[model samples]
Target: MGTRWTISTPEPLPADAVDAVDAEIDRIDRAWSRFRDDSMVADMARQAGRYPIADTDQPLVDWYRRLYDLTGGAVSPLVGQTLADAGYDAIYTLRASARVPVAPAWDAVIGEHAGALELREPALLDVGAAGKGFAVDRVAEIVGDSFDDFVVDAGGDMVISPRSRGLRVALEHPSDATKAIGVVSVAGGAICASASNRRVWADWHHIVDPRTASPAREVLATWVIAPSAMEADGLATALFFTPAAFLRGDFDHHREGFHHVTIRRNGSVEHTAIPGLELFL
Candidate 1:
């Protein structure tokens, strides 16, 4: 919630509804912010052993599990301490420090227990991969069915509900936000873009690979469209590390479809069509 959010609808949001929206965002921030002391996640990470998992943590955990499998650990929530070690700490300070954080074996720690779920490891549980997209989805609930059409843009990650026409979004350069690489059209769903362009400090960026404990260097940015913002957000991050072949595997493209656009570090774009896969000119 450190970023700004913009809501655009056919009509302006009512005063009370705006207040409700703000409150909901604040609630989510308090639950998951590792930078805030009052946050349950911060407290659990600070304690770093055993703590009761909140109901809210379930969504985050479930998504992380799915993403970890999908990307083969390329998108990992257990890299929280790794991020901190790299200078992205509690206060958002960036440093040149590089240290491999202790992996308490998330498998050994997180699972079904007697009455409550617990994280036995010192895992910090970084949900940056899908948190923004998930939040976008959740915030749309505030707007409800009040408006015929609306769009929520949380720092460029978005959820658009269109009554008639689809929305077109420009894809920005990973290193330079001002320059755009291409534009994409989405009718009624979520679009999530994960970039190494920002949230960087020293010699490192925010995106990290849990397997090697380093930043993913192949793709600079990735955009994904899915049925839900949470899925789009999660898969977009995974797209940074996922190969194009995976999306076009055995799955049918029409009935159940996924589209990906990946921007490489060398200023080239690779696009996986909803029904095909190819690189752009």
Candidate 2:
């Protein structure tokens, strides 16, 4: 939510198209942004209570629940407290605490009841793993309603409308932003990527493993393509801790129609054999 975004269409859109998209993004930020004190998520951190869940936010909550189970709890929205303790707080404090708090299991701390979200205890919630992608999908929907074809790019997590030509997306090297390891032609749907090198401070990155309450170091980068940006974004983070085979086989990612590539710490690459993706390494 802190990054830039771009919307591209074949021709000039209506004058209010940008305004509509901007309004939707602002609404999403107000509802879920952990960096803002006035956000609904921030209110949850301040106190434990049954907070109303907007109908638009239900998809995000449902996706979080799905990813929580898909990754076996490796990806969680409940990692906000740990992230803040590790120096990624509302004020952008990059200094890690002497003792970072452990993230509680999702079921142990939160529940959904009668259209409301009830937190058993006060805990900061971070939905960065997939929130951006969800926003991208929403934006795409707004744009699609006006134009049949469009491209919505949110800090590189994108949703491209179906086109015969497709869109060529470069997979940036984990260690060097100037270098690219491969390219994929995204014909349609969404493609989301996560890299450890993007954010770093005091031996920590944004991607934290909730199980260990520490930064995930095994995989340097991950890329996923799915029917929706939300799925792709959530799965990209899930790939950091879970293997592709298990994700595809056990979690039925294969049936769901997605492909992924992961760069490990040793400079080795692990990926699925799928069309459209080509790796130089």
**Cα lDDT, model 2, residue 175:** 89
Error of 2 at 134 (Å): 0.2
> Candidate 1 lDDT, tens digit per residue, 1-281?
77889999878998888998888788878877777779867876766545554565466667667677667777777777788888778886687454566434457656652234466654576778888887888888787656758898998888888546567688786767887767777887888888887787666788888777778788889888776788788888887787866744622434656677888878777776542222334
Evaluated at residue 266, the lDDT of candidate 2 is: 88
Q: Report model 1's TM-score to 2 decimal places.
A: 0.88
Regions of model 1 farther than 4 Å from truth: 48-57, 102-104, 113-116, 247-254, 274-281
Identify the candidate with maximal TM-score: 2
Report lDDT (CA) for all predictions. 0.74, 0.89
Best by lDDT: 2
